[model samples]
Target: MSAPTISYENHRFPPQVIAHAVWLYFRFPLSLRLVEEMLLERGIVVSYETIRRWGRKFGAAYAKQLRRKRPSREDIWHLDEVVVSIGGRNHWLWRAVDKDGDVLDEIVQVRRDTKAAKRLLIRLLKKQGLAPKRIVTDKLRSYGAAKRDVMPAVEHRSHKGLNNRAENSLCRCENENE
Candidate 1:
């Protein structure tokens, strides 16, 4: 498949500069102003606002293209979740991985519940385009509830011990600021 073209119409800076700025902003945890400062240090005078706009314009397409290039993934899925603090707020990150530890997909939310579990399942279904041959998750009731509703036909192995594959991948967050 041909790669999606990025449009650089009507921007004063060259396409490479705009693309690089957008890439820096999305490819790292740095804030928009930090991206601005980094570019300024490199002798580029673009504003943070411009970097933000570029990220908004091009980030999703770039991510989609990259995902498309990834090889087809394993059918056995191990799913797990952990609580993380981002910007002083608690968030639950649900992640899925194959047995070999390649990340399949992940989602973050404020609540860890049936709805959140279902959303993760739906997203996995949509993105991977195939139901897993088997899903292994911890003994969370929400996973059972979601699986019954979302993909009852697929085999589900729920065991706190069996899901170590997914759990080990989490690298649980520790609050270092304390």
Candidate 2:
């Protein structure tokens, strides 16, 4: 089911300010203080705490709206993760792609363990409000472990090449960053 609408009727600030603050917070990795400063520079006086609240309150609504705009996704899902080196630290970027090559969801974490896999799966389930009929991943034991717990009824395939769609999409993102 689609998410119910959230009302912003009682807030003191104009809806525009609230929307802009939420946009700035999610559009970039800026901290709340930085977002507050940027809004102040634009002559909008809002506190960092207020921005944080707005993010906590409205982020889901925005995400829901965006998802509703997308075409309904296919039931077959491809999942993959790759190591990304930032400075001297290693992080695993996990992603899920549907049969049509659309990104269903993504997450970045330091560990590529069962917990991380479970988290990605849970988040994807929550965001899409639908579970895939099948999931394909590389031969990662973590994915198998997570799949059993999170989506026991769904089919899980562990193959080296089945998840190339997600990996290739991540490559395109990395290429743009470079």
Clashes per candidate, residues 3 or more apart or on different chains: 0, 0
Best by TM-score: 2
The local lDDT score (0 to 100) that residue 147 gets in candidate 2 is 90
Candidate 1 residues lying further than 4 Å off, grouped into runs, are 1-74, 172-178
In model 2, which residue pairs have backbone atoms overlapping below 3 Å?
A: none
- Give a tens-digit lDDT track for model 2, residues 1-178: 7568778888999888898899889989999999999999999898999999999999988866765344243588889999989789999989988877778888899998999999999998888787877899999999999999998988898999888877888888889899
- Whose lDDT is greatest here? 2
Q: How far in Å is the alpha carbon of 129 misplaced in model 2? A: 0.5
Residue 166 lDDT (model 1): 84
Residue 48, candidate 2: C-alpha displacement in angstroms: 32
lDDT per residue for candidate 1 within 1-178, as digits (tens), equals 7776988889899988887898888888999999999999999998888888889888888787766334343478899989989999999999998777778898999999999999999999998887878899998899999999999998999998999888777753223333
**TM-score of each model, in listed order:** 0.57, 0.59
Regions of candidate 2 where Cα sits further than 4 Å from its true position: 1-74
